[model samples]
Every structure is written in C-alpha cells, then in structure tokens.
Target: MNPVLGQVPVYNAYGSVPALPLGWVENYTPTGQPYWFNTITNQSSWVYPMMTSKKIPGTNWLFVLTHDGYEFYYDRDSKTSVWEQPEELKEAMQELKKLEEEEKLKKEEEEKQKALEEEEEAKKALEEEEENKKRVLEEEKEQARQEVKRIKLDQAVDNAEDVEATEMTEEDIMWQLQQMAEEEVGMDREEEEEVQEEAQKEEEIKQVEKKPELSEQECIEKFYQLLKENNISPFAVYSVELPKLMLDPRFSLVPHNKQKNLFNKYCHELGEQIKKEKSQNTKKPENEFKELLESKVTTKMYWDDFRRKFKNDPRFKALSVTREKEALFKEHIRNNLNKKNPIEDYKNLLRHVKEIQKGIRWRDAKKLLEKYDVYHAIEDKDKREDLFRDYLDEL
Candidate 1:
C-alpha cells in the first residue's frame, strides 16, 4: 500500500510473489525529512528526525548468502547497504533505536559534566592566585613599615621627642574638635575660645613640665604654642597619651608623690622670652616651640614623665620598678617580632572566627568550602560518574 514498504507479489522466476513482509522498494522520503534507505533489503528506517539526507533509491544492493541471518541488499551504483524488510521484526528494531538514543544522551551528559568540572577548577585556581597576590602585597607593605622604623631607630633621635611627641598635640586636635562642635551647634567663637582656654591651659602645663615646674595656665600656653608651631592637632596628642595618664592632667590633677604644685607660673615668663626672640627674628613662635619641645623630650624625660603620671598610683607602686623595666623590654621585642609572618601563618590554622583580625589562618578556606557545593556524582549503568564541580557565583 505504502510505497516506502512495498508489497511483494509471489510468483515463479520471472516476477511477482505477493506476501506479508517480503518486499523491495526504493526509498521515497520528501525533502526536509530524515531517513536512511537500505536499498539492499528494499527497506528504509528513521533515525533522529531531521538528520542526514532523504531518499536513497535506484541502485543494486548487497546480500549475504552464507547465513541469511538478517537479509540485506547492496547497491553497486552507490556502494551502500540496506536492511531487508520483515514486518515481524519492527518492534525489535524500535527497541534497538531507543537503546541507542539512551547511550548517546548518556555520553553527551558526561561530556557536559566534564566541561563543567574543568571550568570550576580553573575558576578556583584563579581565585587562589588572586588571594596569594593580596597576601604578598600585605606582607610587602608591612615590611616597608618595619624598614621605616628600623631607619628611625638607627638615626636614634635620642635628643629628640619620642615618636608620639613628634605627632599631633592634644590642643591642636582639640581645637579642631571644638571648631567642629561650634560649627555644628552654631556657637560664637568668643564662648568656645573661652571654654577652651582654661581647659587647654591646664592640659599644656601637665604635658610640658609633668611636674611642679609649671602651673595649669602655663601648661595651656606651652601646649598652644607647640601645637601652633607643629600645625598639629591637640586632641590627637591627648588621644595618644591619655592611656598613660592616671588622670587627664589638664581637666583633673593627680598630684604625684614625686611632684607637687604641678602647675607653675611659667606662661608669662616664657611668653616674654618668646616675645623678645620674635623681636630679634621674624620666625613663627609655634615652630620654635615645636623644635624646642622635640629637642627636650629625651629618653630620661620619658621615664620621668611616666613616673610623674603613675607615681601616686598604688597599683604601679606595688610592682617593682626593676620588674617593670624587664617587662617593657620584653614587650618591645615581641612587637618587633610580630611584624613578621608567625609560625601560625605557616600552617593552616582554623579558628571559628569569620574575620582575620590579628592573624593569618586557613579558616578562610574552610569557610569557602562550606559555603559552596564542591563535587557531585551521577550514576550510569554499573559506573558512578563524577559530574564535576559546580560554579559558585557571587553570594
């Protein structure tokens, strides 16, 4: 009935035998249709749709005479093979095609998984490289900072101010703070300056003399002078030193056992001396004061200053001064050593902390692993296949 599966007419020698299944026909698939024509057996079959070419016909086909297990035909013109038509075997052929498709799909999925894994590995490697770069940069920056300290130490500013002293003063920084507050609260300069004057005076005295040599007002003037010269912030100075002070010397006085009348009447005398100096040279007053202060703060001054601030404290008195000195030396050494990568940094030490605060550790890796899906597997036949690593996009 259908030309694709032609009817065979059973007849003697010359022509036609009519029957079920036995047939010979040229394939006649329309354009845009997919078919594989086996003219050998005068039969054609469909593979995946829209695959290959259509219509194979008008040629002699091959045959196997020895067994005839499954009939076949060959075309001398096209040198092609075709399967023989057998109506009863159609179901078996369909099953074979289904199995073939399954195999193909399985292979394709495996390839996709492999590609995915490769991409994930590449991505991880890039991330690791970037992290290493960042770590190296951080170490280099730390080294530079240490080198700077080494240079400063070698120069040995013994006759000079300590590192903190060369920095901002309490008065200079406080002035800026006061300025900000005044602007924020919309206050007049006269009121703010007046409030600041007393406070500043008291502060200056404690810093300059740190003993009975200077009074509160004189301290204020000295502080003011030094701040102006260095163009430093007074608040910043106080911020740096407040830890060492048993009490803020300007606002509150803690009369140490070693020093009494810690505030002195040096402001007017120093002011006059400054005025005379100015008459001789036009150099700025604050600059002169800054230089003088820096030159005067010797190592002896550091110990003396500390003693003055803490001498009255019962707690410090409880500790032996000899013991304190040893402790201080040990602390300095440890600080220097801490500038390098410690033994902990060499190992991947995991802490539960999500932050890298004072140390370098391997907790960051564990965290990344936990947050991402790493490996996956698929089962096919008797084999278990690793589906590869999935990518982690931005969280």
Candidate 2:
C-alpha cells in the first residue's frame, strides 16, 4: 500500500516498534509518508528526522526542528513555539532583567547605609576621646589641690602638737599633787601650803610661756615671705592665686580684707621690681637696635626698605621678633629722624629742596618735593601741601 513503508522498519503496531532515540519514534501517516513523533512533547510532524529536540541549558526552552525542515524554539510547559525564540522565554528574560536591576539598587542602598553608619560611629568616637582628655585634666587639677591641702594640714598638726604637749605636762603635775595630798591626808598644814605655793609658781611660768600676738605689718610681711617661699609669680592674678594661697598656714593670720589689701600692695611693688629687672636685662639689646636704626634707617625709608637693606646685619637678626623690631624702628624715627614732630621734619625737608624756593606755588613745590622720599613719607596729599605752605610762610 505504501512504497516508503518498504524502506522503513515494519511493525505490527506503534507500540510494537523497537526502541529508538529519546523522545522520538519513527512512524507513517495514513497517506503512508514517513514522519516523526515526540513521545515526551506529544506532537507529531511529517519530516525525515535529523535529530531529536534538545532542551536549552538553564531554561524551559527546547531547540526544535519541524518535520517540514523548519527550525524554531519550543516551550513545552506553555505549549508555544516560535520561529526564533518563544514568548515565554522572552517574558522570563524580562523578569530576570528586572530582578538584576533590583539587586543592583539594593546593593547600592546597602553601601550607602553602611557609610552613614561608619560616619556616625567615627563622630561618636571623637567625642568620647575629647571627653576622656577633659576628664583626665580635671583629675590632675584635683590632685594638685589635694596635695596643697595636705601640706597645710601637716603644718597645722605640728603647731597643735606643741600646744598639746605643754598642756599635758601641766596636767601631769596637777595629778601628782592630788595623789600626794590624798595619801598625806593626816599630814601637817605646812606641807599642803608648800604644794600650793609650788602650783602658784607653775601658773606664773605658764603665763610667761604664752607667745605674743603679731602686728598687722608683721602679718603682711609673713604673707609675702610665704609667697616667695612658694615661688608664686608677682604677675599672678589675686583671684586665681587666692585658692593656692589659702592653703598656706600664714594666710589666715591676717584679716580677710587686710590680706586682700596686703596682696595688692605686695604685687604692685614686686611687679615694678620685676619690670625694672627686665628693662635692665633688655636695655643693651634695645640700645643696639636703636643705634642700628639711626645708622642704617631714615625717615625717608619705609619698614620694608629697611628690612631689604639690613636683613643680613647681625643687629637686625638679633631683634628676632618682627613686631618688636618694628616698634623700635618707630621709636627711633620719632626720637631722631622726625624728632617727635613730623610736620616740622617735612617743612625742613621742603626747605632743603633747592627747587622749593620761597613764594613758589604749592602745586609746583609738590612736584619738586615728590622727587624726594620725604614727600612720599607724608601719605596725605593735603597735609603735604599745608606743610609746604607753612614752610613758605616761614621763608
């Protein structure tokens, strides 16, 4: 009935066929043409098989060829086929792309959150470090205060011990007399009278042992001595130094108001002494600086000009501080060059200018004076013109 059936294997029925490739079976249509059947996909086609369909790796798609020799992709779960790729595979890829974007966004958010947390932690750690330093400084100050208190307490205890020892000696003598009187209760009255005379002489000796009170001047001198012994600076402020001074045993000897007055008086005298000493110490160098300025600098020269001219000199280098050297230069200018009279110095400068003859107009004289450094020394144009007029009047 069919010529192709003679070329293919003959079977009594489709179930009676021998084993074949996976998901594939050789069969014939009712018209007796050769075709293929997929036992797994349950689909039939009429084309000579080259190979069975295979699943694409990691996907629900299969690489398929039709029995008519057309190639495409197939999705068995959706039972859909396409010439290039199945719609289900495209949808799955879209879902995967969305998931990847979401994952990337989630990762970035995690990194940002982690950075914020680290920044906050760093700020907290810095605050803690500063707090610890402050705590340590406070502890050190407290320890110093306590040490000063301990020294004053030790001195007070020594003075108290001396007074207590004298009182204890007197009490022992009285106790011995009492014991003797009780034991000699039947003895004569002359013995008791002799003991009373001895006790009266002891009372006179105790009165002589008492120390005299110090005068106000003596108390003030003692406070100064204490300050010197402690090496306190005369420039130290009274309020700041009061706490340390109060720890001294001599501090309480004077009345509070008197102590304050005495402290002010002592500091004033001591500060003057220190100032005089410093002035004496620095006088030589100051004189040297003044001499350098007189020799090398002039009123015509500015500070920068002087620096450029004498920067290499030993005297200039010796005055190391910029402000101090500038101060000395100004003082030298005031004393020597300007003679504490800048207007007169300018007038003299104008008189010296050969071009500035008497009765010359201020405008013409200013042009001539401008050629000299002294003209530029007076910064105000109006002042220079006024000084020029004054010099003309003198002429």
Candidate 3:
C-alpha cells in the first residue's frame, strides 16, 4: 500500500479485511509511469508486476492494472485524470449533451421570434388606437361645424322674420292716403283764397298804371324781368298768375283760348329760366324726406308741420304736389330704413366710405352709397365727395 493513499483497510472477498491487499505491490517502480490517480476514490495505487499492463496505443497513459481492479486515464498535457465509466453510460452521456445543445439553440430561436411578434402586435395596437383617436377628433370637428351652421341658419331665419314683422300694413297705407288727401284739400282751399286776395290787391295797385295796358311782348318782357328779380320757380308763379294773366285787360282783344295758350308758352319759358337759376340750390325731396323719416318723423302731423314751415319753398310744394307722389316718397324712405344698422352705424359707414373715396375708389364708394336712400340722390361723383366733406365737417 502507498503511504500517500492514507492508512485504510482494504476489503477482499468474503468481507475479510486486512491492513493491505493480499497481492498489493510494495515499493513499486515502472519503466514509464503515468502521472494519474483513481478519480472516483481520489487515490493513487501501486501496480503489481504480475498483473497485465498495456500501453494505450495513441495516448500518453499506459493502461495498467493492480491486484484490486480500477481504471482511469490521464491527460498528458493538462495532467488531469478522470475515471473510465461503462461503455453504455458514456454513449448515453454523449447523446444527452448533444440533445441539450440542440434544445438550447431551439429555445433561443423561439424566444427571438416571440419577441419580434410581440413588438409587431404592440405597434399595430398603438396604430389602431391612434387611428381611432383621429377619427373621433374628425367626428367632433364635423359636429361642431354643423352646430355652428345650425346656429347661423337659425339667426338668418330670425332676422328674416324680424324684417317681415316691420313691414307696413294695409291699414297704415290707407291712413297715409287719407291724411294726404285731407292735406291736399286744405292746401287747395288756402291756395284759392290766397289767389283771390292777391288778385284784389293787384287790381288796386295796377288801377293807377293804366296808360293803355302793355302789349303782349311788353308784358312777357316784364314777366322775364320779374322772374330774374325774384329767384322763384315758374311753377310757383304759374300756379297763381296763369289764370289772372288769361283774364288781364292787356289781353282783352286776344281770344280767351289764345291768351291762355300764350300764358302757357311764357310759363314754359319761365320754367326753363327758373331751372337754370335754381338748379344749384335744388335738392331731391326724396332724399330730404328720407332724412326726416330717419329722424322718426313719420306722422302726418310732422309732414303737415314740415309743409307749413317750408310752404314758400318751391321744392317743398313740388314734393307735396300729389298724394301719389307723397305716398311714393314715403315708400321709398321706408324701403331704405335699415333696422339693423342704426343711425350711428350709418354715420360711421359714411366716414369709412369717404376714406375709400379719397383713394379714388369710386366703384367701391358707390356700393356703400347704395345702402342709404339719401346717397342714391348723390349721383354725381364730385357731389358725393362734397357730401362726404360736408358731413365730416358737421361731425
């Protein structure tokens, strides 16, 4: 027994134990020894010369046997050793190792594929979620737009109803016509009385100037001089004096019809003269009445007061000449009454249009001017500018 194997008893057949094996070699030596130990027992043993010893053909270890059988191999380079197992066990272990490696590789590939699939699933889910959100937002926007459109449409309907509500009734038209007829009848009576009184006064004044009454030509020359002196319309004079002229003694020899025709001819000539002289001062009563209407002067009382105040003015008389004319004038004014834009807005728009006009944008100016009835009468482009300046000065 080798001293390095430690002191231990060796067992033989029949369980007889001894301090050492029966055929154990003592002080053993060999020509070439393998640096090896029994790996299973972690011990080195002595080899007996009588036991068979064979050198493994292609390895460094010499296969040796001792009286007690045990086998192991040594690595020449690593100088490490392992016990030899049974042939069946060795084959089974080799197969198990190969199978483990193949299973490991397959498991790794499966894990990688799973990860790729999970990533794709997550991306698809996120895309679907985003698409749903975008669709929902679009739906919300469309709903909001529809709601706004509905509100605007409702507002338009309400405005149309309001406009319709403000329209004049048939009763109002009849009332206006009745008032106009009454005012015309009163004006006619007053005019007839004034004409009679004026004729009486003229008879007394001309009684002393009867130095053989003036000829028709001289009478016409005097009439022209009177028109030049008095800046009055021919219609104003014609309404009162045409009949008087037809009955005057200066035209007694002339047939009554001839005198009437001559007076009409002179009246037309005087009208032309009046037109030339008063054209600059003439204003459209339609426009003036529109202003008064805007001022809330809609009653017949107001109109009658206006007529009494400006009775001497030919323009006022012209406007009130007929009930039809008066009704049309009021209708024109009512049609232009914009309940939406108050007087203040009208003034402000007038100023804004003026600024546009200063830049020579006449077409744009005309469009704005059309909103107000008074502006329609401002037909002349230069006159519109003057009106703008005058209104600004007033402001």
Best candidate according to lDDT: 2
lDDT of 1 at 17: 34
lDDT over C-alpha atoms for residue 245 of model 2: 71
**Per-model tally of clashing residue pairs:** 36, 0, 0
lDDT scores of the candidates, listed in order: 0.42, 0.68, 0.53
Q: Estimate each model's TM-score.
A: 0.21, 0.28, 0.22
Q: Judge candidate 3 at residue 350 and give its lDDT.
A: 77
Mark the regions of model 1 whose C-alpha exceeds 4 Å error after superposition.
Answer: 1-84, 87-92, 157-395
* lDDT of candidate model 1 versus the reference: 0.42
Q: Which 10-residue span in candidate 2 carries the lowest summed lDDT?
A: 7-16
Q: By descending TM-score, how would the candidates be arranged?
A: 2, 3, 1
- Writing each residue's lDDT as its tens digit, candidate 2 over 1-395 gives 22565432222322434344566788887888888888766778775445346566568776665555655665666666556554557765566557768989999677556645654566587679968976796687567656755775677568556764455577766875685565446343544675588669868977875535889778777889987877766666566576567745587677754665677788788889999999877757656777798788867666778888888988888777898997777656555544456766677787677877777887777677655445555668888877777777877
lDDT of 1 by residue, 202-313 (tens): 5896588565567766766554454344433312333233233322333233333212122222334545677798787875434443333334333223334544655555
Question: Which scores higher on lDDT, 2 or 3?
Answer: 2
- Top candidate when judged by TM-score against the true structure: 2
